[model samples]
Target: MEFHHLFSFYLTIITLTTISLFHSSKAVNPIILPIFKDTTKPQYYTTFLLGTPSLSVSLAIDLSSPWSWFTCNLVGFNDTWYSGVPNSSTYRVQRCTDDNSCAVYDSNYCYTCNSPNCKPKGNMCTGEIYPPSLYTGGSFYGGHLLAPLLLDIITVYKSNGPIPLGKRVYGFSFGCTGVDDLKGLSRYTKGVLSLARKDSNSFHGFITKAFKIPNKFALCLPSASKSTLNGAMYFGGGPYKLPPSKLDLSQFFVKTALVVNPIDVGETYGKRNSSIEYFVNIKSILVDDTPLKINSSLLVIDKNGLGGTKINPIYPYTTLHTNIYNALVDAFTTKAATMNITRVGQVSSFSACFSSKNMVGTKTGPKVPIISLKLDGRNEDIWRFYGFNSMIKVSNDVRCLAIVDGGLSVKASIVIGGKQMEDSLVEFDLESSKLRVMSSLLRFGTSCSQFRGA
Candidate 1:
């Protein structure tokens, strides 16, 4: 049989078989041929499978906005408003209307800005008579323009330190394609300022012209994933370090800003739609890093019962692990030294054709053995160790196989002599903190004729 055909067959049986059989016996019978009696000899060497586990998918978000005096001022007013009410004053300042549009009388019988518009129309008309002209109804003027007045409130509130009204308050929400877009928005303030100041007729131009100066105060929202910017914060420009004053901006933005989490963004944008698959095959087998030189052949048998065969001498690395390669050098050297097969002419290869169920947990095929051995020798006595039941009967020889999963340890076994052997099971338990070895064995006999029918 050709080597490829033999390897293919081996992979097929193991992948298709799930049921495993275990048998233990002490009887020395005709089929119980033994090549070596020394149990102290080690048969296989160990090596580890190196690879990292796959990473899960994830996402990130960024945001930005405009800074105006109106915003700062509104923040300041709200602070004062909240502070004016004493904590001991338990009475909930209930408004006569749902919108808190009821007036409150102060020490001098002066009415507060409880009305919606503060204009003397309808419910806003206060007939109270203290500080007469103070009833002009402009008390709640700041409340009327609350949203746009935030910029000014913030400016005053910060300049004079914490006001009794609490901290200035502001809020905003928006969406973008990804981190880049978010950064773009954050840096957009500079461009907006430049454009507004450059023109004479634009609204910004009116402010610039009236103030006789450009608005240096720029508003910006913080962005996430600053590391992606490579030690620099990315805004409108490629990358930039935020100014000292803007450093605290991130805190405010993080506190009150509403950003779309990465997971949600991925779902809405359809970015999480990719996957990958993998497959692995063992081309050659070695014991203790030694390559077993076998004069092996291949045989292909199809479901139709038709088969063909090919012959070839298995060299160290031909289709599998090469002898010259450091990986299999020790195994080949050890096997060759122990078998005493010095010359290439001393080895004769044979092919065996047997069908078994591919092995489970194996991706290649079904009812197959987890591990297999091939020998190139004439004396059935020498190759006896490679026979069907030899692996099950021998305890020390089974340590040649290794099974691994997710960097964790798992138990793996192979069928031998028509029965399964627990001692034949191999364990692969290499963690980043620790390492282990994986090895297998092969036995060869003297006289090339003994391997002719294998």
Candidate 2:
């Protein structure tokens, strides 16, 4: 008994008991032992009794080899002892015979319990573990009124009708006088002018005053001597001057020597009948080369050459009437065109005269033009101008007289077969009661000149 001898004796006893128990159990059930024999040892006492005779101990102990154990533990082990290892830390395992090298097992294996978490080789893990909702596709991220000014212009253009050549004439005059001041006004003025040039149906208002050619004049009177006719004569035309008080150099101009013509007349009380006519000979300066056709409605003024050099009284009155008449005409024409009606007939001769009065009386005059119209397939159709009190009546069957006041109001009465059939104010204010007087004066064969002075 020494301690070393005792320890060896105990180990020998344990091994002998284990062998005996294994041998005894072999008769009932084969007991396989996991052990490897040293091939270098001699046969008798030198050979280690590593396993049973019929059982292959090497197979069970294969995994115990240094190389095998190292691979098993390094790759990933199922044993619970490695569960506490931190994913961030590395662990070293024993080397195996197959590859006598120690390997490190990182958190990857620890997270997956070291099973197949350790891939020997092949295939890769890609993509985020937790992706955003729209990660698969790109993130989605919304649209203003372009050309606001242009849009405004279009809106105004759509709402209104074409401008008249006469207005262009006035515009040119104004532009010329204050060429330096009216620089930017061209944009809007040009837009208005474009309509006049492009559209054929545009109309303008004109003023007329009655002048009687003397009855004593001979038929061969010379053109220069025509002024000698002492009879009262009506001369109406315009390149009406704008009142200096209300004139805005940026907004308006004047035209000189515009011409007005007599188309017809309406009866007054007993003997007076107002004259009606279209204003022709309006001189429009060429600004944009837009074409203008004859019979196009126009606004004209007498341009009587009154008022101070810098200030004109007749201009403002004429301008006010023209603006109202123009607006009214446009409204009616546009509405009629929209309705597909072809003819917007003659303006009410009476109302035209009244409107003229209002124009001279106030700055904000009537803005609607009264027109008399005869549509196809219809006779005696009277329509109130869309934006004005003016009425247009058709009378192809009989001669009709239309009269317009100096301010632009109109009155029309029909005379058929030498008998005045209908007398009416082709235009009238809502509050006016004088239309009744005009109605009574319409009699057959009534002379239009008798009522012209009204």
Candidate 3:
């Protein structure tokens, strides 16, 4: 396999074994969502169109998050981003009256089955309510605090190559939340767009089966500075072509089996279910081709379901466990010294930083040491991070190593964040349990912002 180029998946995955949507096929056109990197929340978000008249809502993207919730009329609270509940014939709190699973969920809280609506499920609704999200990232929008599970009509814009065609889908499952639960989220976005695994309970899963499409998606996250206004996301079927050269980005993809982390990373992991988060088996990590001294045990999943490496785009930077972090920073600092790259004062969350005066810029990014992640491939496939993704600029005079110490209590030893993912293609095949990754695309003279972008 070539050592250069990159590919991976999020909600938008390029089809490697593409199935055409013929007139006689059961397939529909795949939905294309333009992804935006919001400086407000310092996170990525996408526009979600929902309901009868179609409310264009902003939603933050969280790959591991289970609920795709938004601020609707949980109470009388009003806003432009909130769902227009009054005139919406399809916007209603999904009642548990017909669901035996809901009744078995919390029999103590179960009541006489009756009518339900946009009314908050506190004391007003008479059926069993789905459990609220964990208090940390849970929901509460109205005076009524039950956080009713909501079923609404959602609009997915199908891709006709670079252009989009709208398709309205019913039976979309999500949570009805309020502004109070919006803490840590962008002030502009109403809710989160979860790209969790395609199990029976997730948003991605519902849409895949509902649309009769494949359970795979791809992501090409863009920086959008001097590039296109946004990035590209494809939900299903694709002949993912980029203009000018019409390069197939998926041709660069190398497949690896995705492992499941048996425990959630949340504080409430014990009370809830095991995490559906995506994890990859990283055999080892290297700096400048010389392997860093790391505990091999930390690279493997322990019996308690801790250790291993996780892929989470919710956070913007890569985080490492303390021991591995210490080893990496030391090795990187030593390698920098060999290159005569002067170190400066430490910045918050980053231990190693340098003065920009001594650095030279190149087409790829700043000239720096390469970081490599060795994955268990047939002939040893390794994902390399060059100058751009490896080093983050903190100030005009300073740039720091783009990795953070994730403390000792974390589940995954290495949590891959979004910053390192920019300008790359990623695809996840839930049906095959495989993760397709192309580490970087800059060398190809094209970035993600230029491919299928807004």
Candidate 4:
């Protein structure tokens, strides 16, 4: 029997799926790779080749992270690390004084010490600490790694063959990560890949320098049911950008100006460090084409001035602010009232549930409503979420609204998560600072590999 990647639909929804970016090869066109989601491990991974000889390492992709690190000579786990050492001539450590080192991560600057050990005035490798990252199961933790950054070759596989992008930096001031504590990490985690900002020696930045393509990337995460890479990711340029006459699914693809979330710079650093958070303003959300009845201000940016909504691939369920959450539940409940379904009790972390007589059947479920998001206050710039994206099938006879409450700890009003993003191609154009959402794959009924992106 095939090992099915199935879990209790309810518990799996709350499980954390942390995404980190790894540096990828740059070519004339976008390099395509298969993303593997393991339901047993509750993890997402993609394979990449690294080092001079090029070895395959399945790494977790995290866009919010700036560090690209893999375990080397790691002990006490049934895992694969980089093993021994690479040729120092090609994969070497970067000095703290190197301009490229500091340029990769401004926070990597070791102000107090001159060296790896933080000597009073010695030159050495820089150390950095990451901000606390949240996993929806009620926990937050931070990790740190100390290593000298290095510029090396990384090869990625496309339909043709292996292609290498040279002189690309492995930032966080290190070629290989040192002994560190990665708390709350998935057991299948071999390394962390980062698609950091352009100025930060990021993977996309390397693509821009090597391929001369726009500093942008697009990704589509497949549904949890499929274990294979039904989804796709494109670097270099958008997968879809056709003319008006050629427009089909292109019309459904909504593009909106990206919003920057202001981060507090440390008083000691004197430099603003950025993260991979795709922050954007959500003007409003609609269920069944009716705008939700909530305070417009609540739907705007946060009190701290960060964008009110962030499209986080790591978070599995869509988390909403308490006020906005209440409004959505009320509205969705009213919409369900019209159907013959009856409101069921809550399931695990979910807010609402429903049950119907026909729901016990294999394919029968509620007449799920359509949910849409208005971006940057533009009515035209809307991203719609269908019934499957907004709701979850908890049991054979029970289905639940997949939304979760962000609670008081969360700053953002809404977090558009993986559940809403599955089966849809979302592009993040760093050059134009815009986000494009499309349902073309479903509209055209084409596989990701066959898309022939423009």
State which candidate has the highest TM-score. 3
| Candidate 1 vs 3: which has more TM-score | 3
Candidate 2 C-alpha lDDT tens digits along 1-454: 1232233223323332322211111112211111111112100000011111111001111100011111112112222222322121222221222211111210011111234443222221110010111111112110000000000000000001111011001101000011121122211111111101001111111100011111110000000111111011111111111121222121121122211223211111111121221122222211112222222232232233111111111011112133334443344444443434333334433232222221221111133232322211222222222211122122432111222222332221111100111111111111111111121111222211121110
In angstroms, give how far residue 48 of model 2 lies from its true place.
99
lDDT of 4 by residue, 199-235 (tens): 4555666656665667787776756534323344567
Between 1 and 4, whose lDDT is larger?
4
lDDT of candidate 3 over 19-118, digit per residue (tens): 1111112235676666667654367776655677655666777776655666665322232123344446666554445335464322223223223542
lDDT against the true structure, each candidate:
0.17, 0.17, 0.63, 0.54
Query: Cα deviation in Å at residue 330, candidate 2?
Result: 11
Provide the RMSD of all predictions against the true structure, rounded to 1 decimal.
34.8, 51.7, 7.8, 7.9
Distance from true location, Cα of 165 in model 4, Å: 12
| Model with the higher TM-score, candidate 1 or 4 | 4
Model 1, span 1-454: residue lDDT tens: 2332233223222311211111112111101000101012111110001011111111111010111111111111212122232111111221233223422311111224434432221221111111101111122111111111111111001111111111221111111111221122112110111111112212222233333332211111111111111111011111111222122221211011111112211101112121000001122334533334432221112232111111111001012212112233334334434543221211112111122211122212122222333212111101112222211111221212111111111000111110111111111111111101111111111110111111
Error of 2 at 301 (Å): 16
Model 4 worst lDDT window (10 residues) = 13-22
Q: Distance from true position, residue 293, model 3, in Å?
A: 0.6
Instruction: Let me know the TM-score candidate 4 reaches against the reference structure.
Output: 0.75
For model 3, how big is the CA root-mean-square deviation?
Answer: 7.8
